[model samples]
Target chain A: MVERTEKRHTEKMKKKQAAHDKIMAGKTAEKGLLIVHTGKGKGKTTAALGMVVRAIGHGKKVGVVQFVKGAMATGEKAVFDAFPGNIEFKPMGEGFTWDTQDRARDIAVARGAWDEVKRMIEDPSYDMVLADELNIVLRYDYLPLEEVLPVLTGRAPMKHVIVTGRNAPEALVAEADLVTEMTLVKHPFREQGVKAQPGIEY
Target chain B: MVERTEKRHTEKMKKKQAAHDKIMAGKTAEKGLLIVHTGKGKGKTTAALGMVVRAIGHGKKVGVVQFVKGAMATGEKAVFDAFPGNIEFKPMGEGFTWDTQDRARDIAVARGAWDEVKRMIEDPSYDMVLADELNIVLRYDYLPLEEVLPVLTGRAPMKHVIVTGRNAPEALVAEADLVTEMTLVKHPFREQGVKAQPGIEY
Candidate 1:
């Protein structure tokens, strides 16, 4: 009788313990990582913005630095307006590089923007960072990939960083923890002959 | 002098004309929107994986669903482990409500698993929706937000939805118009004797 009782008791304990193991395990993790959203597709900036909202929803602090495509009043501005003090929205305006006749001025703006954004990446306080449209900078060679990578990866406070734009360099892809390539199957501009719109395009 | 002036005016007028309007003018948009991530995160079978990723990205397509997270074997599995797949990861068992509990059964297995996840957030083919915390399902709810959202949204076309969780949500977030969230902040677990090692509490 004792032997039988002992066996039953052990089985019950095993069952109980299995139940306990599931939730208690895997609850801890490091603080930060990187996600790169790039490709020949649209929505790179939009994806970064989406992440910004998701981070904020979970009660995280986030910053957005637009490396290109900064004309003004994009919808993301509405989010910035709604949140007010919580979010820092910085738009690095170059509008369209091809249209900028002044090469010196264009280079100046690119340089100025990178210096500002690089400073932000190095700061450990930000919970999440969005380097919007920064891909173009790398693609256009406005910034050196090697110089930017270590700073972005190292000092991020274990916080999250998102870099978005088209034509991300192969080197950048290799370094990213998570990388997404947006492929454009079709776009409306091809049919309408309409120029880019405000709020939407900018 | 008058004839010369007229000719000069005509020449200038006929020289060239170009117009540019951004998309924000409400000209074009992604036809259908939804998110699917077979990547990683804490919970699965807890929410529909598509709704959140999309709405947060673009403002199109809506009404989709998933309970539980993507399939396991990723970073998310480390975080969520064997959390519930029922009632969208009910914290009642091991919900991480306060963050201090052995919480194996309460955290891992749920009552119905896919049976339960299949019930909530039905059909993301409609319009914008939110599949909050669906990853818990994977622990028990095991519904694979990836397999579900992709086929559904791909078939629906021209709608938007979002899916939220860690570990990729990749396949979905990749095809998603937008994807992002959860960089992690001052979590309370660190104060406790918690460490996010793999399998057990990643």
Candidate 2:
């Protein structure tokens, strides 16, 4: 029985190896990417920041422009702050939509954040730019899709951009090279009846 | 009109504050959680490590047990290695199942890794324990859920445990306080014909 299992496993391995090698052989082109993290679940921003951290680890310059979550201090911001030279972070949003009901102000702030994004993407030094929560701003129509889409497509060829938030637009989704939607399976707010906590939520 | 907009904004802020305060009033209980990152998309492991980086930023001890990815060096494992005292990491797996074509050896390694998990959870020194890719082992039945669930349920109240992998069982999902399913919308492998890249996929 052991011999049979070993033989079967070896056959399976040979098949998988061939497929992996063939697929990888066709994958030679390398360039920058526009990655999107969106959906009705947690870890959208967290995953983007994870990429940022990875980029920083690889000695790549990273710039983060937080579009709609600047009201309170977060642990991520604090951690990024520690890596001063490696990270350039700007948390420019006023707060959530309900917290700031002024449409004009939200638009102005989002534009300011976008300007920063433009600067970061254009700068040759920055390899990765994270537009944190830019999806929410776009969803609320604070920034016109025509304007934002053009800027994204015009980014540097070697610069990776990560846009994160819920309800990402279909146009942006179509434009992105990689996209991951975080699905809500279970949440403390809905399941355990708990609010967001530090280190976990922030 | 400007004055009217300002007044409307003030009223909105007042209503939002009241709602925020009301929701926060019931959120006095603070403790750790069992967070599961699973699904068909990417970022399951990245999100879990993002939490680990956040915990390290907050000066907490972290223990990471990598179940099935120990062959090649990853950017995350490299970054975590920089912080010696803060992170205790064990990349216990030989590799993925296909890479290691020995089922008996895979089960043995998984069991050895689970022993490390048992030690970490009971040590009381680790504030957060990340069982990275534990789901894959459980999915293959290398380790039974009956044995694993009890150890998880019996963990310290203040300790946070994050389990990440694909095909997480329904029982573990039920036991978790937070679960995020990363859904694949667009992948480089599928769309752009690219295999995993350094500092991004790793």
Candidate 2 lDDT, tens digit per residue, A105-198?
A: 8889999999999899889998889999999889877789998898888988877899999999999999999999999988887656576766
Best by DockQ: 2
How well does candidate 1 match the true structure in TM-score terms? 0.51
Q: Is the docking of candidate 1 incorrect, acceptable, medium or high quality?
A: incorrect
For candidate 2, write residues B124-155 as lDDT tens digits: 99999999999999998899999999999899
Instruction: List DockQ, one per candidate, in order.
Output: 0.09, 0.56
TM-score of chain A of 1: 0.78
User: Residue A25, candidate 1: how far off, in angstroms?
Assistant: 5.4
List iRMS (one decimal) for every candidate. 13.3, 2.5
- Encode model 1's per-residue lDDT on A1-202: one tens digit a residue: 8567556655665666566675456445454656676656455565565456555544456777776656534345544454554577777856655455344565677777777677767766667777877777777666788888887767554667778777777777776656655555334465434344322333
| Alpha-carbon local distance difference test for all models | 0.49, 0.85
The reply for model 1, stretches above 4 Å from the true place, is A1-28, A71-73, A185-202, B1-202
- How well is each residue in B22-110 modelled by candidate 1, as lDDT tens digits? 33354444544344332332222222321233232233233323333223324222212222221122222233312222224323333
Q: Each model's TM-score?
A: 0.51, 0.93
